[model samples]
Target: MKKRQRKVRLIRAAIQLVFFIVAPALFSTAFAGVKSIFQAIAAGQPVTWNSFLDVTGALLLITVLFGRHFCGYACAFGSLGDAMYELTLFIRQKVFHKKGRHGYPEKVVRCLQKVKYILLAFILLSIFTGWYANLQGMSPWDVFSMLTARKLPNASYKIGIILLVLILIGMCTQERFFCQFLCPMGAVFALMPILPSALFKRDRSKCPAKCGLCKKRCPAHLDIDGDTPLSGECICCHACEATCPRKNIQIGQEVEELKEEAAVSKTPVKREKSAAVSK
Candidate 1:
């Protein structure tokens, strides 16, 4: 189980690195598609198929089919957040002799998660009102995109650079800080009507009473046992599945198989107890 968990993490990290280097602008590109549609609408122009639509449509289809795996393993900003958080963990553990990670209060995190949705609404309103055009150089993502493309931002990007710095600082303090609390793209993904079969599932009956190892390990602090709407905010990182000591969380065919195995394992104990009572 440990080996499998390590392998999953390694594969996810490698995928993240590849996407970070080769397609770091994917999130921004998809967002550009959304903006173009609204801008066209605001201008009374007919929407036509373009690269922006192509990218946006494709990603939305993928999210509906496979959950938010893109956010978990391919988004460049998410990769950057992961790197920053990992560095913080290293520093805390090695230099300060403290715990490698910190868990925020669940209530606080839940409230913070709503902020991205509000931001998304604000951005859409700006675009529809033509105010987005006046808000140039104010997006942290714009600064990140420029820096990743090896371009030095100009004076026009001062606000963006400042926001980027603050976001990076937040990233160091919390795992997936941007994805969890600030990313408009993440908010869009969360609102997607993802297929239930695509979302990870947990068998609460198999979980030890009072055990919340999976929730604690989740970067989004999601409740894996259906207490929360699993498809709403899950990024499909599978952290809960990997961290479960009972191996109770899974998706697809694996879920049914785990239940069968559990049933089989209990049959003998039940028979033994029955035999002892009869004797």
Candidate 2:
């Protein structure tokens, strides 16, 4: 790894460690503060502006710009998945490999995923349109807090167990399952379907054969050989670029840089001369 990338990965790993340790303890308080902030802002009540933004807006800002990497790398549940995954990998390698693995019911993952998007829309609408009560009742953070605090009901607790099971399943398969599939807070970030200012664009001209290095490294199952990933399903994990033996795969600062370089290389010298004369 380059020095800068190695440093970033190390920093990300450290932050993930801290979040894993500290967040569950703080989740309830975070819930209370965020609710208060949202209520204050929605009502246009006599609330300090700093306090409102600190609670309501700052969290969203960080989550949206950074991608759900914050969840995969910084969330408490993420740590749980990571720790469990290594053990599970060992067990499965030793035992379960011969017995075909089973996936958790995708019904809940796909259908319940839609529920978060709907809930997210409602929350934003309610917050902006003076109907804060609509959202306040459905905040998943509150659900998460209540579950963690041991105040959730028997049925709810069962459902939480199912969620935990699903999370484990995701770790064995996709690295960021809850963040990718379920968390309503993550719904906001996952919907930010923009090409990264910098991205791993396959150089088709240089790459003649169906090079397989990038795809093999991607945990998300993206076919990098095909084109830029269209599903917005990527977490910007650069494992593919890292493992490319051909070294054709790289993280670019912008798509434009690759385009400009391609254009410069392909242009005829006569065209440049003509353009210079015309100028």
Say which candidate scores most in TM-score: 1
Candidate 2 segments whose C-alpha is farther than 4 A from its true place: 1-15, 22-56, 59-68, 97-116, 119-162, 169-174, 193-195, 223-232, 255-279
- What tens-digit string does per-residue lDDT give for candidate 1 at 131-249? 98878999889989998899999999999899999999999888899999999988988888877678777767788999998889888788874324645788888888888888788
Deviation from native of the Cα of residue 67 in model 2, angstroms: 4.7
lDDT: worst 10-residue window of model 1: 223-232
Please report, in order, the local distance difference test score of every candidate based on alpha carbons: 0.86, 0.55
lDDT, candidate 2, at 60: 49
Per-residue lDDT of 151-224 in model 2, one digit per residue for the tens?
A: 76445355445555555676676445555555555565555544453345656555547666565445455555
- Per-prediction TM-score: 0.92, 0.57
* Most lDDT-accurate candidate: 1
Task: Compute the lDDT for candidate 1.
Answer: 0.86
Model 2 pairs whose backbones collide: none
Worst 10 residues of 2 by lDDT: 98-107
